[model samples]
Target: MQSVALLLIGIQLVYAGKHSLQYFYTATSGLPNLPQFVSVGIVDGQPFTYYDSKIRRMTPRQDWMAKSVGEDYWERNTQASIGSEQAFINNINVVKDRFNQTGGVHTYQEMYGCEWDDETEEINGFDEDGFDGGDFTTLDYKEKRYISPVPQGLATAEKWNRDGSLQQRKNYLGTICVEWLKKYLEYGKSSLQKKVSPQVSVLQKDPSSPVTCHATGFYPSGVTITWMKNGREHHEDVEVGELLPNEDGTFQKTSSITVTPDEWKKNEYSCVVEHQGKSVTEDEIRSNKGDSVPIGIIVGALGAVVLLIIIVVAGYKVYQKKKGFKPVNGSDDGSNSSAHTVPQA
Candidate 1:
C-alpha cells in the first residue's frame, strides 16, 4: 500500500511536470511579435504600403539619417496619390485572395528603392563637423535608400512612389522581421495574434454604451491608452482600466467606456485594448469564475479516513500482542504452585 501510494504520487508529479513544460513552451513560442506598421488603405480597397520603422534602423546612415536630416524634403517631395486608394485596396484584396487559394503558407518578398530628394542630397556634404562652403568640400552621396525584401512567408502592404520607386509602407528588413510578421499574421487570423492586431471584444450592451480602451505592452511605460467610439480614437469621455500581467509574461489590460443602458441593450459595445507594441481583448465571455473548494473538501475527507484507518490498525496490533503476551513460569503448569502446594511443604 505504501509502495502504491508512492507510485501514485510519482505519476502525478510526472504528469504535472509534463503539463508545466508544455504550457511553458506554448506561452513562449506560440505567438509572434506583432508587426507594427500603418495600413495604407482598406485591405480590399487600395494598394498601400506598410513601412517598418524597426527595419529602418538597420542602415541608420541612410534610412534613419535620411528621415531626420531630410524630413522636410522627404515629406514635401513624397507624392500622395488619393485617387489610387480604391485601386490599392482592390489589389491588396487580390493578394489576400491568392493567399487564401494557396491553402497553406504564403510567401511574399517586396523590394523598393527610391532616390533621395534634392535637399537631402545637398546635405550629404555636411559631416559631423560643419564644412566650409566649396565644391571640393561638398559632401558625397554614399548612401541610397533601399528597403530589404520581406522574405517568402509574410504578407506585407507598401506603396509605390510617383517615379515608380518604392515608398515607405511595411519595411521588410530581412529574415527576422519577415519571420516575425509571418507568425504575427498567422495569429491575427486565428484571433490570437497581437503585435499590432487590435484586441477587440464584442459586448452586447446598450447601443449607446460607451466603450473605452486600456493598454500595456512591449511599449514604453508612458504610452497612452485611449478609447474609441465606433472606431474613433477617444479623448475626453471614457474611462480606462487597470493593467495586468499576461500568462505569457506580456501584459494584459482593460478599460471601459460608458454610454447608456440603451447602448448596452443593442450589444454593440466592445472593449478595445491597445498597448504600445501589442494589444489583446476580452469580450462577453459567457462564463464566470468557477468554484473549487468542493473538490478540495472531498479530497481532504478521504485523506483523513485513510489516516484514521492506519492509526486504528496499528493500535489493534499493539493491543492483540499485549493481550496474548505472558511471562514464563518455572512450573510446567500454567497456574502458580503457591496456589496448590501446602505452604511450600
Candidate 2:
C-alpha cells in the first residue's frame, strides 16, 4: 500500500523537477454574459503574473501585466476558452467521476498547490479545490481497494491519473514554468534592487498580551525570523507563521511569544532578522536605533550584492535522492484529500 502511494508521488516530483508549482484550473460559467472564468496559475504561490488559460500563452510578467497580450487578442482567446470550457471539463470529467466515497456538493471549486520548499527541504502542502469533499479511509500497502478520493493535493497526483497525453501536458507545464520564471527575472531585474532592511515591530494585544514580531516589505523571502532573549534562540512559545505575500511583491512573516508585562519591560526581548547574509538584532525598534541605510542611497561602488528570487526548485535533487520522502520532509500522511466538497459517500 505504502509502496503504491510512494510510487504515485514519485511521478509528480519527477515532473515538477526543482521548481515549486502553484496552479489553478476553473470552469465555472453559469451566466451567459459574464466573462469566462479565468484559470490562474502561480509559480511560487505569487499571482500567475504571466500565463492565463484562455490562450495557453505564457509571457514575461511585464508583458502580461502591461496588456502585451493585447485587448483584442485577449478577448478572442477568452471567448474561445469560454466556449471550450465544457470540453475541457469533459476531458477530466471532474464531476460525476468521483475519486472516493467522500461526499459533498461544490459548484465552484479551486485548486491550490505548494510543490517544494528547498530551504526547508519539504514538499510544502497540496490543495485540490473541491475534489472529493470528505474525510478519508486508510489502507496499508496490503489491501487498500483504490485511491477513491483522488489525491489532487499532491500537485502531480491529478495529472498522473489522467491519460498519457494529459500526463505529458502536465509534465510540459512544469517545464514551461521554469521558462516563465527566467523571463520575469530578466524583465524585472531592478525590482530586486530595493533592499528595505527589515523593520521589526513588536505588538502586544493588551497589557497582559502576547508579543508578535512583524517584518514586512522585504524582498527575497529567505529572511530567517526568530525570537531571542538575552542572546539565545527560543522556539517554545514562539509561533512562527509561513511567509505570506505582501502587496508590493515583497514578503511578510510574523513570530510571536507570550510574555507578561514584567518580561516585556525587561527589554530582554528582541526579534532577530537575518537577510542577505547579514544579521540584525531589533530591540523592538526603540529610539536607540536609526535607519540602517536610507534604502535610497546609491551603491555604485558597493560591489556585488546577491539577491535570491522567490522560486522553488531546490527540492528536485533531494526529492529524487530520498525516494518520495524522508522523515524530515514530513510524512506520507497518504494522498488524503481534505476537500470540503467531496460528496457524501
Most TM-score-accurate candidate: 2
- Could you estimate the TM-score for every candidate? 0.19, 0.51
Candidate 1 lDDT over 120-216, as tens digits, reads 3211111000001101001111432222123211222112222222221112211222232222223232222222322333332333444433333
After superposition, which runs of candidate 2 have C-alpha atoms over 4 Å from their true positions? Answer: 1-21, 26-36, 43-162, 170-174, 192-195, 260-267, 277-345
**lDDT by residue for model 2 (1-345), tens:** 121121112112122123444433333334334322334334433343322334454333333334323454344434443433444344234443444322333223333333433344444333333322231221111121112234433333333344352333233333333343444334344553344555555565566556666766665544556666655666777787756556566667777677666665564555655555333332324222223211111112221122223332222211111111000011122121111111111
Question: How well does candidate 1 score on lDDT at residue 261?
Answer: 53
User: For candidate 2, what's the RMSD?
Assistant: 12.8
Task: Give the whole-model CA lDDT for all candidates, comma-separated.
Answer: 0.21, 0.37
